[model samples]
Target: MAYRHPDRETIKRILEETDTIAVVGLSDKPDRTSHMVSAAMQAKGYRIVPVNPNADTILGEKCYKSLKDIPFPVDLVNVFRRSEYCADVAREAAEIGAKTLWLQLGIVSEEAAEIAEAAGMNVIMDRCIKVEDSILLPEGKTNR
Candidate 1:
């Protein structure tokens, strides 16, 4: 009954192929980790959509209160909420048909991961997206 993520190769494939990401709990504050990570992804040419109930816009992109409010399909849902809230995000990710559900560093929920995996969505837990992206790049290709 435990959830197991796919191998590194599969995760790499998912990350490399994803072009758009919906950043749940993204914040407008410049000092916030969510903002920093979103900025990094945006610089890498990935379309970043900020999903936060209080944010109107972050990094020049329009913000949405929830995943369901996003008009277009997103390849990944990068969650920044606490572990206790991840299951809800995972459910919403599945409901909105996101291809992947990623729990940001320090946030992990086995139940959420299982739910996402069961929905055929790729799952990455307790990992920083920026860090993973950097590690996935070859020696000479890394910018960070």
Candidate 2:
């Protein structure tokens, strides 16, 4: 079955409600898209947890090797990995009881969406989180 993303209002609500975002594949390199996006989100007051096995820290946040390795709760799992790897991510997100599974711009996987949705996780595919936040909440969401 084809996967459909949530509506604009729901997306806005997700942003408004989300506090901590676990960024999968977040790179330590400043030039990387993942790092840029995560940094933007962090600047917007969202807690960004860098999930990368290769990095000890990024943007001053300790990096976790995997979702399960995160000791705290994750509001959303923002994935920067390739589409082929997202299903595994979705499963890990579910395992960690993440509320949402978001695949970044230009990446989509129906399998990943299915797994996450079945686990009661809100699934957003092929969308940039920072772009959506800037568009939907121009004033920015209050983490308070």
Candidate 3:
């Protein structure tokens, strides 16, 4: 069966309810898409945990080497890695008890989505979280 993303209401609900987002593959460089997207989310009041080994910090948050390294609970696990690596990240996110697994635009993995869904995580593949936030939660309707 094909994987269907959550409906608009569900997506809006997830965006509204989530607080802390662990961004896997986030970069410190301002020019990178991961950095820009994460920054946009942070500006909109979501706490972003940078999960990149190459840097010590991004957006003023301490960088963790992996999802396992995050000391606190994460509401969402947003990934910027390639499709081939998503399953591993999904497993880690499940292990960490994250509520959602979000694959950035151009990234998709059926195996990852299956694992996450089985673990009770809401999966969103091939979508930009920043764009969703802008489009779904316009004019501060669900800004928190």
Candidate 4:
């Protein structure tokens, strides 16, 4: 079978420990998936850094032109781009010493996953962090 990314326990640990997330391809449009997901993460007490080549701001956070432009350490690099673009972003994420590379739902690239894993970074592909977080929340806790 293909490499099953970290087991459930490991994934939970990573999610619990990760505090800051850099959302690549983030857009200012409220209707965009990236925007909505980032907003949800922020609501859950995670610091969200917006990364977009064309945006100046998103969710009140300064929008970085690229992953390399972010001045601080990013615990997680949440990719919101097309599959073809993920490998490049994964390269940058690895170079920047990010702890994890999370490819948003529907955005999957084996090459990207391999690159990040080779760099000793955790990788999650074809999944939505927001949805995962919601699913993992306590029984009565609101995901909103």
Candidate 5:
């Protein structure tokens, strides 16, 4: 069967519930999209955990080399990596017990979706988390 992303309501709920997001492939450079999105989310009251082997920190948060390296609970695994890398990220997200696997805009992987789904994760592919948050919770996470 074909892959199916969650609806608007579910996406909104996921955004509302998520407190910490582990961002895979996050870049330290401010000009990068990953950095921009993560920064925006952080500004909106979400904890942005940077996952990058190269960076020691991003957006003032400690950066872990990989998802398995994060010592605390991550509510969502927000991937900025390419499509080919997502399946591995899904497994790591599952291993770390995250509730959601979110592949950023223009990135998607059926294998990644399958792996996350099998582990009972809410999968969101080819979508930007920052954009969704802006549209759904326009007021920011002020109520949270």
Candidate 6:
């Protein structure tokens, strides 16, 4: 059977319950979408973990070289990497016991999604978390 993302209500629940987000391929450059989106999430009180090998810090958080390097438990693995690299990120997120794997807008990898689902991780693909959060939990109100 084909895979389907969680329903709108489920997505809202995930957003409300999740606190920490590990962003893979996060860049220090402010112009990048990854940086901008992460910044927005941070403003909403979500802890952002930068996972990039080239950077030491981003958005005032220490950058981890990989998902496995994060010291604390990650509630969500928000990937900014390309679709080709997502499977690896999914594996790492699963290995580290992440509760969710979120692929940014324009990124969709069936293999990665399957891997994450098999590991009991919720998967969100081709959608922006910040947008979802805003739409689903506008002004701190759960639009359920």
Measured over all alpha carbons after superposition, the RMSD of each candidate to the real structure, in angstroms, is 3.0, 0.8, 1.3, 3.1, 0.9, 2.2
Name the lDDT of candidate 2: 0.95
Local accuracy of candidate 4 as per-residue lDDT tens digits, 74-99: 99999989999999999999989999
77: Cα error in model 5, Å: 0.6
Worst 10 residues of 6 by lDDT: 135-144
Task: Write the residue-wise lDDT of candidate 2 on 1-144 in tens digits.
Answer: 688889999999999999999999999999999999999999888999999999899999999999999999999999999999999999999999999999999999999999999999999999999999999998887646
Report the candidate with higher TM-score, 3 versus 4: 3
> Which pairs clash in model 3?
none
lDDT of 6 by residue, 1-144 (tens): 467879999999899889899999898999999999999999888899999999999999999998888889999999998999999999999999999999999999999999999999999999999999999987763323
Among residues 3 or more apart in sequence or in different chains, the pairs in candidate 2 whose N, CA or C atoms overlap within 3 Å are none
Segments in model 4 whose C-alpha atoms lie over 4 Å from true places: 139-144
Q: Write the per-residue lDDT of candidate 3 for residues 101-140, one digit (tens) a residue.
A: 9999999999999999999999999999999999997754
The better-scoring model by lDDT among 1 and 5 is 5
- The lDDT of each candidate is 0.87, 0.95, 0.94, 0.87, 0.95, 0.93
Model 6: lDDT equals 0.93
lDDT of candidate 5 over 49-114, digit per residue (tens) = 999999898999999999999999999999999899999999999999999999999999999999
Model 4 TM-score? 0.92
Candidate ranking under lDDT, highest first, comes to 2, 5, 3, 6, 1, 4
Please give the lDDT score at residue 42 for candidate 5: 96
Each prediction's total of clashing residue pairs, residues at least 3 apart in sequence or on different chains, is 0, 0, 0, 0, 0, 0
Candidate 3 runs further than 4 Å off: 140-144
lDDT of 1 by residue, 1-144 (tens): 766656778877777788889999998999999999999888877889999889788999999999999999999999999999999999999999999999988888998998998999989888898887777743312232
